[model samples]
Target chain A: GQQVMQIPQYQHVQEGEDFTTYCNSSTTLSNIQWYKQRPGGHPVFLIQLVKSGEVKKQKRLTFQFGEAKKNSSLHITATQTTDVGTYFCAGYTGKLIFGQGTTLQVKP
Target chain B: EAGVTQSPTHLIKTRGQQVTLRCSPISGHTSVYWYQQALGLGLQFLLWYDEGEERNRGNFPPRFSGRQFPNYSSELNVNALELEDSALYLCASSDGTSDVKNIQYFGAGTRLSVL
Candidate 1:
C-alpha cells in the first residue's frame, strides 16, 4: 500500500511571507500531484511532477519532485488572502492517496 | 465545458438511515472517483469506477458502496449511516489515461450530515 504524508499541518504567515509544504511517501510514486481547496470548496488541481528532480513554476508558486520520486514540495511566494486554503499533495497509483493537507492562513 | 457535477449539494440523514449521492462527470470522461473528507481531514479515497465497472476501492466498509452508470455517471450509497459518517463527499472525473497524468477534476461535493 502507498501512503502520502505532509508536514506543517497548519501554518499562519504574514502577507509577504513565503510558505512551503512537503510531501513524503512510504513507497516510490510514479508521479505526484498537488491540489488546493478553499474553505467550503472542493479540491482543485494545481500542478504535477513526474520526472526525477523535476521542477515547475506557476508565477509565484514552485513545485518540485524528488529524484527518488518519493517526495515533493509546493512553495508559494508573497502570499495573499487568496492563498488562504488547504494545500494537498496526492500520490497516485491507479488512484490517488491524498495527504492530510496543510492549512495556510495569511494575515494582511 | 462543464466540470464534474454532484447532486443535492447537501444531504441530511439520521442514524440507521440510508443515503445516496450522485455525480455526473464532465462530458467525454470515462472515469469517476469518490472521496470522503471529514472535517479538518484529508480526502480519503472511497471508490473508483471506470467504463461502468468497479476498478478499485479504498479501505472503507461494505456499508459504503456505489455503482457507475452506462454513461459513466455514478451513485454512492451509504447504509446504516452513523454520526461518524458526517463528512463532505467529493466526486471527481478523469479520462483514466496517463496523458492527463491521472489528473482529477472534482465537483463541488455533496456535504452529508448524519444525525
Candidate 2:
C-alpha cells in the first residue's frame, strides 16, 4: 500500500512571514499534485510536478519535487491573511494517495 | 466548463440507516473519486470509478459501495451508518488520461451528520 505523509499538521505565521510544508511518500510516485482548501470550501487544484528534481513557481509560491520522486515541498513567501487554508499533497502511483495535509493559519 | 457537482449539500441520518450520495463529474471526464473528510481532518479515500467500472477502492468495509453510470455520473452508498460516519463526503473527477497526470477537480462536497 502506498502512503503519503505530510508534516507540520498545523502552522500559524504572522503576515509577511514565510511558510513551508513537506510531503513524503512511502513509494516512488509518477507525479505529485498540490491542492488548497479554504475554510468551508472544497479543495482546489494548485499545481503538479512530474519530472524529478523539478521546481515550479506560482507567484510567491514555490513547489519542489525530490530527485527520488518520493518527496515534495510547498513554500509560501510573505504570507497573507488570504493564505489561510489547508494544503494537501497527493502522489500518484496507480491511483492517487493524499497526504494528511498541513493547515496554515496566517495572522494579520 | 463546469466542475464536479454533488447532490444533497447536507444530509442528516441516524445510526443503522442507509444513505446514498450522488455526484456528477465535469463533462468529458471519465473518472470519479470519493473521499471522506472528518472535522479538521484530511481526505480519506473511499472509492474510484472510471468508464463505468470500479477502478479502485481504499481501506474501507463493504458497507461503502458505489457505481458509475454510462454518462459518468457516480453514486456512493453507505449502509448501516455509525456515528463516526458523520463527515464531509467529497467527489472529485479527473480526465482519466495519462497525459494530464490525472489531475483532479473537486466539488464542494456533501456534509453528512449521523446521529
Candidate 3:
C-alpha cells in the first residue's frame, strides 16, 4: 500500500505573500498529479508531473517533481484572496492515492 | 466538452438503509473511479472500473460495492450503511486507453448524510 503525505495541514497567509505545500510519497510514483478544491466544490485537475526533476509553471503557480519521483511541491507567489483553496497531491502507480491536502487561506 | 456529471447532488438516509450514487463520465472516457471524502480526511479510493470491468478497489468493507455500465457510466452502492458512512462521494473519469498516464476529471460529488 502506498501513502501520500502533505505538510502544513492548514495555512493562513497575508495577501501578496508566497505559499508553498509539500507532498511526499511512501512509494515511488509513476506520476504525480496536483488538484485544487475550492470550498464546497469538487476537485479540479491542476497539473501532472511525470518526468523526474520536472518543473512546470502556470501563471504565478509553480510545480516541481523531485529527482526521486517520490516527492512534489506546489508554490504560489504573491497569493491573492482568490487563491484560497485546498491543494492535494496524488501519486499514481496502479491507482491514484491522494494526500490529506493543504488548506490555504489568503487574507486581504 | 462536458465534464463528469453526478446525480442527486445531496442524499439523506438512515443507518441500515441502502444508497446508490450515479456518475456519468465525460464523453469518450472509458474509465470511472469512485472515492469517499470524509470531513477533514483525505480522499479514499473506493473502486476503479475500466471497460465495464472492476479493475481495482481499496481497503473497504464488502458493504461498499459498485458496478460499471457498458456505456462507461458507473454507480456506487452502499448497503447496511452506518453513521460513519456520512461523507461526500466523488466520481472521476479518465481516458483508460492511456493506461499509465490518465488525468482524472471529477464531478461535483454527492453528499450523503446518514442518520
Candidate 4:
C-alpha cells in the first residue's frame, strides 16, 4: 500500500507572503497532480507533473516534482486573500491517491 | 464544455439504509473514478470504472460498490450505511487509461450524512 503525506496541515500567512506545501509518497509515483479546493467548492485541477525533477509554473504558483518522483512541492508567491483554500497533491498508481491537504489562510 | 456533474448535491440517510449517488462524466471521457473524503481527511479511492468494467478499487468494504453505464455515467451505491460513512463522495473522469498520468476533472461532491 502506498501512502502520501503532506506537510504543514495548516498555514496562516499575511497577504503578499510566500507559501509552500510539501508532499511525500511512500512509493515511487508515475506522475503527480496538484489540485486546489476553495472553501465549499470541489477540487480543481491546477497542474500535473510527469517528468522527474520537472518544474512548471502558472503565474504566481510554481509546482515541482522531485528527481526521485517520490515527492512534490507547490509554492505560491505573494499570496492573496483570494488564495485561501486547501492544496492537495495526488500521486498516480493504477489510481490516484490524494494527500491530506494543506489548508492555507491568507490575511488581508 | 461540460465538466463532471453529480446528482443530489446533498443526501441524508440513517444507518442500515441504502444510498445511491450519481455522476456524469465529461463528454467523450471513458475513465470514471469514485473517492470518499471524510471531514478533515484526504480523499480515499473507492472504485475505478472504465469501459463499463470495474478496473480497480481501494481498501474499502464491499458495502461500497458502483457501476458504469453505457454512456460512461456512473453510480455509487453504499449499502447498509453507517455513521462512519458520513462524508463527501466525489467523481472524476479522464480520457486516458487507468494507470500513469491523466488530468482528472472533478464534479462537485455529494455530501452524504448518515445518522
Chain A TM-scores, candidates in order: 0.97, 0.99, 0.99, 0.99
lDDT tens digits by residue: candidate 2, A1-108 = 788999999999999999999999999999999999999999999999999999999999999999999999999999999999999999998788899999999989
Residues A70-105, candidate 1: write the lDDT tens digits: 999999999989999999999876567799999999
DockQ of each: 0.65, 0.72, 0.64, 0.67
lDDT of candidate 2 over B1-115, digit per residue (tens): 8889999999999999999999999999999999999999999999999999998888899999999999999999999999999999999999975834599999999999999
Docking class of 1: medium
Q: What overall lDDT goes with each candidate model?
A: 0.92, 0.95, 0.93, 0.93
- Looking at model 1 chain B, which ten-residue stretch has the lowest summed lDDT? B94-103
- Chain A of model 2, TM-score against the native? 0.99
Whose TM-score is higher: candidate 3's or candidate 4's?
A: 3
Using all chains and alpha carbons, the TM-scores for the candidates as numbered come to 0.96, 0.98, 0.96, 0.94
TM-score per model (chain B)? 0.96, 0.97, 0.96, 0.96
Q: In lDDT terms, how accurate is model 2?
A: 0.95
What lDDT tens digits, residue by residue, belong to model 3 across residues B1-115? 9999998899999999999999999999999999999976778889999999999998899999999999999999999999999999999999863526589999999999999
Candidate 2: pairs in clash: none
What DockQ class does candidate 2 belong to? Answer: medium
lDDT per residue, candidate 3, A36-86, as tens digits?
A: 999888899999999999999999999999999999999999999988999
Stretches of candidate 3 off by over 4 Å are B97-100
Number of the predicted model whose DockQ against the real structure is largest: 2
The top-ranked prediction according to TM-score is 2
Arranged by TM-score, best first: 2, 1, 3, 4
